[model samples]
Target chain A: MKVTIDDVVLPGDFCEDIIKAGEKSRVILGPGLRKELEKIFITKAGVLRKRAPNTYWVDSYQKRYVPARGENVIGVVIQKAGDSFRVDVGGSCSATLSYLSFEGATKKNRPEVQVGDVIYAKMLVASKDMEPELVCVDSNGKKGRLGVLNDGFVFKCSINLVRKILNPSCPLLNSLKNEWPFELAAGMNGRIWIKANSMRETIAVGNAILGCEYLTSEEIKSMCTNIASILAGHVS
Target chain B: MTTKRPQLPKSVLEMKFMRKTRERIEKELENTQGHDSLYSNIITNEMRHATGNFISESSFIFCEDLLEGRLSYKGMNPEIERLMEQDIKTSDPDGEMQKDVSDEILYKKMEALNKKRKSNDTPNKNPVLKKKKKF
Candidate 1:
């Protein structure tokens, strides 16, 4: 095998010897050549131990907090409650919002929120251990962004995506566009808020954001703009 | 300037802040129930047995010796010693001698070790590193 140290390439049979012996092996290329050779060493396989789910791989004391007031977040309605619903928003506890939070003043036209609905709501309250309180506000105190969710799929991903999406112009979001109607907010407490139509479209957008390997501020903004355009019905 | 109300000392202000934070966190912990508290830590697999029963003091000493590398099949029960003889091989100098001996060429030595086994004649060294006894 040929290995490169810095810019200089050295010719040697390294990988063949290790595989023939069938034992744990390591090759030492000094500091000068470590980086250059790292790109060339093709035989080393990543050693990862499989673990069961719901199991802690490291220290167990660390925790991610639920959304708190003033934080933007994404939520999925997992079940319905009296005049409200239970939603999972990336934290251990789900958030809840009452029917009173919606905009519009028609007593007969109460919007129905069902299981699997996705919404982008703001965290109004997070009483230490209690369900997070969420609100959606419009300038007129009528429902603006807060209201019944329709036309979107519910998708789950790491909370990091929430952060990546909130800043806009993240590179990962710019590569693709499927003009979709959706509103997104990320809670300071680590919850993601999303309201979109069509489960398929929502999942498509979520996967694109999650799959972006290279993210830059400009790319994030482009992605946000595309999403907003789709929601505005300007793009399909 | 007119009358002004007294302000809390920095230490007092800090104590109050910490107290409120702790109370808030505690309340959240109570409501959410920490994941660790909800699940058991032990992994119960049938392939390995974890014995917790009492054993004779002498038996424990024997196990401790095995773990310390002072004991092997030779030191254990004689019946186990008989079964291990089949796996051992008598050493030979004329047998395929290793070609390379450099630190960079340890693969040849490992290959030889894997093929050859120890017979009843010479001592069989453990492939695994052994802890040195305290002086």
Candidate 2:
């Protein structure tokens, strides 16, 4: 079946629009779209989305994390291996994080990372045939936001929700930022870690985020206001 | 049938060269001609027309398009907030820079600077010459 942009696409659905655009210029098949020979086929069941210029992707609601290179994911350190630590990022296989990948980590001086510690790191190498590799530091040798996350509540949500809330146009963060003081780390691997002053505040932040999954922009704004008022000790 | 070997530049081979280098160049020409016929049967015309534009990208997420996930609200975590601010600062230097300055204004400023520099140079040279003459 021929599918266009924003259409609910199933696996094996061919996108003629992308093929037509590719003839004129280069077209980027992002995520669930695959190009075999001359035809573009959908690999995942989701809404086919297109960005300006020539970028097409499928926005699917997925809970399992298929490791991808350069994506920042939150993972729990499962075991401390010889030179690397194994981390479970909700993927089929556990990712390996090298000890030297951490910022300022040397052969003599190892980074103090233990098992069960939640870490936010970028996937350095992710492939189907091999185990995924993760790094705590970027190319600049700066940990910069990727490192061991301490004292935060971690919860699971659909990967789509993570992208939705983190979008620049999303008003969820913009409105909630002023409402309360909280720290948030939304991993691309369907995991969110939030920290606030009190338990009530933390739960409220989590609820607000999870609640915005199905709500529209205007509805999310109103929902945020309601949550803020309830947290402020007001019934109405 | 034997093919004639291509000759090297006579000028280069003639100039102060070692016997080893001259032998190497002749050997390289012979090797090239030998390999061409050896693999000519396998090399197809389609291989020559194949382009490098077909890129196989494995990752779903566009790393460049995403923002840093760790963020703080209203100074909840000062460390994370500071890092976020530094990220914004480094990513967009133009936004922090003087946005109103046009190309004409920049050119005019450079021209005025050059004029002032020339005026300063002339005065400094006169003093240096006066000192040199005294010496």
Question: What does candidate 2's lDDT look like per residue over B1-135, in tens digits?
Answer: 377667667777776755677888879879978987898899766666554333445555662255568899899989899988888888887775665989899999999999999989977998899899997
Clash counts for the predictions, in order: 30, 0
Off by over 4 Å in 1: A1-65, A105-109, A138-140, A174-204, A213-236, B1-135
DockQ of 1: 0.01
Candidate 1 TM-score over all chains jointly: 0.35
Query: After aligning candidate 2 to the native by TM-score, how far in Å is the CA of B17 from where it should be?
Result: 23
What tens-digit string does per-residue lDDT give for candidate 2 at A1-236? 99999999999999988888887777777888887666789999999988778888888878888988888899999999999999999999999999999999999999999999999999999888999999999899998889999998999999889988888777899899998899999999999999998899999999999999999999999999999989998422
The candidate scoring highest on lDDT is 2
The alpha-carbon interface RMSD of model 1 comes to 31.9
What are the root-mean-square deviations of the candidates from the true structure over C-alphas? Answer: 31.2, 8.6
